[model samples]
Target chain A: MQHMTIRKSLIWLGGLMILAFLLYTLLDVSGTDLTPQDRINTFSTRFLGIFIEAVPFLLLGSLVSGLIEVYVSKDDLLKLLPKNPILATAGGAVMGFAFPVCECGVVPVTRRLFTKGLPMSVGIAFLLAAPVMNPIVFVSTFIAFGWGEIIVLRFVMTIVVAVSVGLIFAYLARPHETLLPVSFAPVRGGNWGIQPLPPQKMTLIGGLYRAGRIASDEFFEMGRFLIIGSLLAAWMQTRISQQSLLDIGSGAFVSVLVMQGLAFLLSLCSTVDSFVALSFLNTFSTGSLVAFLTFGPMVDIKSAMMFAGVFKKKVVVYLIVLPFLMTLLIGIWVNIWMMR
Target chain B: MNITKIPAKDAIKIMILFGMSGYLAYTILSENLGNYINNSRFVWLTWVAVGLFFVLGVVNVLPFLRPKADATVLLIETSSIMPKSWIVMFICALPLLLGVLIPSQPLDVKSLTGTLSTTVSVSNTTVITRDPLKRNILDWLRAFSLEADKTAFDGTQAQFSGFIYRNPEFPDGVFMVGRFVVACCTADADPIGLPVYAPQADDLAEGQWVEVRGTFLAGEFRRAITPILQVEMIEPIEQPKNSYLYP
Candidate 1:
């Protein structure tokens, strides 16, 4: 059949491409000087660094998602969510305190929740807030900035931004428009949306087996975006100078925009970004630093790519743009009121 | 020979996942984890991830080898493995391949060129300790970032170690001795150093790690009023086991 021929050709082509890449890598590695000065070396190292750092969190998220798929009933999840949309959004914003996941891990968990019939508004809030509003990031930020207004303000602004975004989704978008395709949805009364195993098949060994399969599936599905995202981030870090970007912007407004732009490009994990931001404390204004902290975990290159996997294209665009505008405005206002 | 039929795609996924997890565990066990991640705390997480991947991989692949297992159930379970999933799996495997194939090295002097800037103003509030010789390059850089007047550091003895960085704009006898201060990972590393004035500075090759024992003298270097190290001694040294300074 033509289909079989094409498939065979594609497999052969993929194998050959991988072989070529391996040979190239080996040649590069075997060279006498293998310092990170070379663009190829630097890019590869940083790319692997980001990927390696994120994998553990991603795996944890998948396991949790697997548990959700097996044990947490759809009706029970819905029952836990508040009836009022506003209350539900607030609940979502604060929910991350109890469930602390990094930006890399939050996407798959959000997708799992969404497929289990979680309200879009609440899911959106959790997705954005869970990265920064968690306890780990909170303590990290506190340690980095010390007992300062910046730390307190970061928390306040994060909750505000998350809740507002959630409210917007709740009031503006329809349920179907916000979610992924129906086939990708998690079916009720089944482990991972496959055919429900009989009561006899629902033993402990059977459940563990099902959870492992679901976790593996979810890891591969979400991991592609993480790889591509990290690749872009690494490329930008090597090619673009942070100083050049910082040099152009000086005033409160421009500085906020510049720092926010840097945050998006860097796509650093929330737990560690504060220390990096601290190095800039002397160079950048207070408000710009706040913007960097608030906007980064909410939307970054990596998170944006992950968003594309779960939400509609239009929804993804809003998720990126709205956060930029919100963070920029808040940063400028804070600059005028506090920095002065 | 009642072997259960497993989708070929699921088998491939298991192999890729298992391979990546194994590679991660190897990196940690080999103590090459610092080449990628700056934090030692992440080693335990990597171990846990390896266990998860191995468990999941074995579970997914076991059905195909078992005799008299229901083929119908296996087929239904493996139906989720789509043809497009191969692309995702390939991407996931890429970093692992790169880690193994490519030689690991720390960022070099070239990375410093783009990030270093001359106009960074120091605050006056930095508390300079009485014994200035005890500070590292980062400590000196921090003191430099805070010092309002460069002249205050004059005659202060200092000893520090870092790679040599030469700005083309500097005079023949001047070069910056710089080290990258990494807050989390290499991506966030920022180069910070002090300019040293040595009569034999031209003899030093860039990117070579060296220790400079010198006294801080107030002077203008490269058109900026900054504290310059009057180098009394300079010697080449092996790159430290942990090349990057953690904040």
Candidate 2:
């Protein structure tokens, strides 16, 4: 009961912060002497700026996802998972290195894995960890921050949050209890080695052709979120005074929540989000910035909706709440310990 | 019939993707993409997007080329190409539309977020002493803060270019020459400035790009003791190909 109350209040608090930000943004844009024409022009350029920087990565992500969809067989992957539930779950988190789908691609990929009889906790861990665990993101973050403390902080926090959340579901929830019928039907087989689906076979060129076809569709699917999310970030920058936003970000606790909030709201691809986070380096606390890097990739506007599609509604709540609280606590602790 | 058989929604999506690709290509070829983003990484990335977009559109059309395929194949293809809402199609078309309609302009003298950043501790520090004449406003600004004594800048010849913005309270010969330093994109640009003491400054207009070559003296700017660039030669010039300086 106590846990439920605290969770409820946090949710309410998050909602209020978003609302307050929106209200403040509206007021600031109105007060500026910018004619509607200037406003629209400025917003349009900013939106295009962010969109241009990210679209290439989104294209690459979709292509990689599409190729994986056609070439990588889930039956083979099922055999690779560990026998013990705990080991399997941890392996799932690290397996993101092999199958590096971003927040958007991870969803359909996770869903397909679920249907191939992946262990529930493993599937859950892969879903959260795969976005940031891949090589593309590693290279991008390295380019943005170099081999520095930020990269270490980002990856460390992601693994910790992802593994802990997966273990919670492993200990507390049954596969059938949390997954919807569409996903649960496969899990009903109930073992690491269950192989109900038929094995696939395809020629090299045939797989390439199919991969191209799938990549195109995935591009369209993921591209929608990218376009809309860029629009929101651009619009927010136009409306809110960047200095005032930085001023609010000066506090350790508030900055973490604020960065986390922006992370959720922006819904950028993990491959490119480090560049976005790099801009806030001077003002935001270290922990909050890590929270932005970790939590944004794990659970955000697009990924949350995708999670809803794959899991039961009750489980979706748990998926978001667990990562949110864990990362927030870790972020705050980092700020206090690392800053001084 | 084969073209009409293509789902209307799919057709529009293909066109939208291709149109965006063309718009991106146009920006790159015409040198306008730099107005919106730093092109050091994106020049190649944008070309990749061009190829990917073209490939995506071509692949979508490839199925229509085989009009007389097996019935089961047709059924399977149609299933994945389910008709999407017109609203989503509109949203996807937005970037291309905006790119064409809006005149692409960099953030100019008017958009300074706060007073010009006086003391910035940049994480990526470059040695500012390479060539005093070649130093941009940002490099010089860093040098100003790091110097122990304010008068150390005296007798040092400097030359730099930036758009102009001024304070009304400034003396007749003084104005702020400012540059917007961009790391990733326009969204995070922070404006930095240097005070130029030029008797010819009143003739120059705001947002006008100029090159000032002169020696610096310790002087008051923004009510603080900072290096003031006294102009020996102030020449009006066209905006550089890359307007914003990358750190």
Candidate 3:
């Protein structure tokens, strides 16, 4: 029986290898207009370099995700927030500001927090708010937007989207049932599974180390995603023509949608997307630009995957849907206000 | 009904190899194609990194899917991850890709008139010029309160280029409004305004791109202001194509 299983696994792996080889060949031909095996080594090396650079970071995120699975208890987290929906959501946004990590860094941490027993509302808020509303992100935005009437508006809009999403999800669904934590972390049931009743038994140092381990693991595991996301961003910058986007700069709403679309597709890093958006400054209105900033980091391809890994499929759907609408509304408001 | 999984370690070994293979494939593809596409040396390495990620992804899933295998073989495969030939290949290709992508910062031209072909020739000249000191003055204003130095001019040579911005406070004259220069993005964007000292203010209209080759005449009124230019020529150039310098 085991032999048969081995054979099938081998076959599965072999198929993957064949697929990789064929895809490589197809891409080689289609991309460079090159014949078979002409510059395959060169192409492979370039691709490998990107992966190598990203591995360290990916390992970090994964380890962090793993630790959170091991150490944090979810029950303790639920006690922090009120059952009331509005207060809970607002509390989530406030907690998001406490962490200074970017969206990439936030992924594992968030999953760990959710696993540890944080309420669904708070977890959702951390996911959305940490990327944009955290102190580090806020300072970056302040510097980027320039201190104008729009500065306050950007902050308010980000908080609104993050809090509203968290609150809506909290009332709509509970964390345990909604985010599919069951598959990832199967905690033992009963009192033994729970840390001893007296929480103060552990020293501060011990708790700090545990927290550090969890954070680092999260960093390593998700590092690859960041690397991949950044590379895709660079590719978009090089391959995708900006002129096409430039053509639709006439209408405010159309322009906002297009720019937001570009943000989603481009998936540029938060550190760099500001500059890219600024490049479009003369091309699009401020409102559209705001939409691009708010939407990109919140729901890029990678963050979406993280959501899938941690939350329930239903919650993931809402997580994606709500912020998108909120961003559009904010964009329109900014446009109308700017005109006035 | 009974498919075996590879041992966790062996699966990891395969993933590492797959990652390497993906890297090899990407490099070959890019070297031939990247140059023709608008390639940057800074980002050329990015493709290779991407390819490596495929290998990492392969490794990442190995433990989950690998059929349970023996410990000895897994150890051998793990050691094989680093061999002499692989290292040599990586070193040889990196510099070649970098050579093609770096040292060129291409400007994106938005105006029909502004777009210049990569083939456009620029002759190096010894002429010393700056965007304008008025821009510097405006930057100072942004940092500190705006103190209109009606008497701030010293008749010193100041270079400037920008659209004309009329200040309602000083309707008698106009200020040369230019966006501040930042290497990366608007996060660092600063604004600067230069004092216009031309005789016929109406001749140089707003939004007309021009190179001002005159000296600053520090004075409050246009009547007292003087602009000395050994070369006072106004030629219409293309509007600034890139709205922000580094977005």
Instruction: Using DockQ, give the best candidate's number.
Output: 1
TM-score of chain B of each: 0.81, 0.89, 0.35
Worst 10 residues of 2 chain A by lDDT: A190-199
Q: Is candidate 1 or candidate 3 better by TM-score?
A: 1
Scored against the native two-chain complex, candidate 1 gets a DockQ of: 0.45
Q: Write the residue-wise lDDT of candidate 2 on B1-247 in tens digits.
A: 3432666876897788789778889999999888877787557878988888887777666666665454336335323532256866776788888899898877776455355665554456535765988889988877776676989999999999988877777777888888877656665566778888998668888779998999999987667788888899998899887888776
Between 1 and 2, whose DockQ is larger? 1
Candidate 1's residue-wise lDDT over A144-248, tens digit each?
888787898888898899999999999999767876673244542333444555546577877777767677777777788888788778777766777788888
- Identify the runs in model 3 with alpha carbons over 4 angstroms from their true place: A1-76, A182-238, A312-314, B1-247
lDDT of 3 by residue, B9-29 (tens): 435434443544454345445
- Superior by DockQ: candidate 1 or candidate 3: 1
> Model 1, stretches more than 4 Å misplaced?
A1-37, A182-193, A198-201, B1-8, B68-84, B113-134
Q: What does candidate 1's lDDT look like per residue over B27-132, in tens digits?
A: 7777766756675546676788778888877877777777745655664654453334566767878887787778777776755426344433233344656367
In model 2, what are the clashing residue pairs, if there are any? none
Candidate closer to the true structure by TM-score (higher is better), 1 or 2 = 1
Q: Clashes in model 1: which pairs?
A: B122-B145, B123-B146
User: Taking the candidates one at a time, how many backbone clashes does each contain?
Assistant: 2, 0, 80
* Order of models, best TM-score first: 1, 2, 3
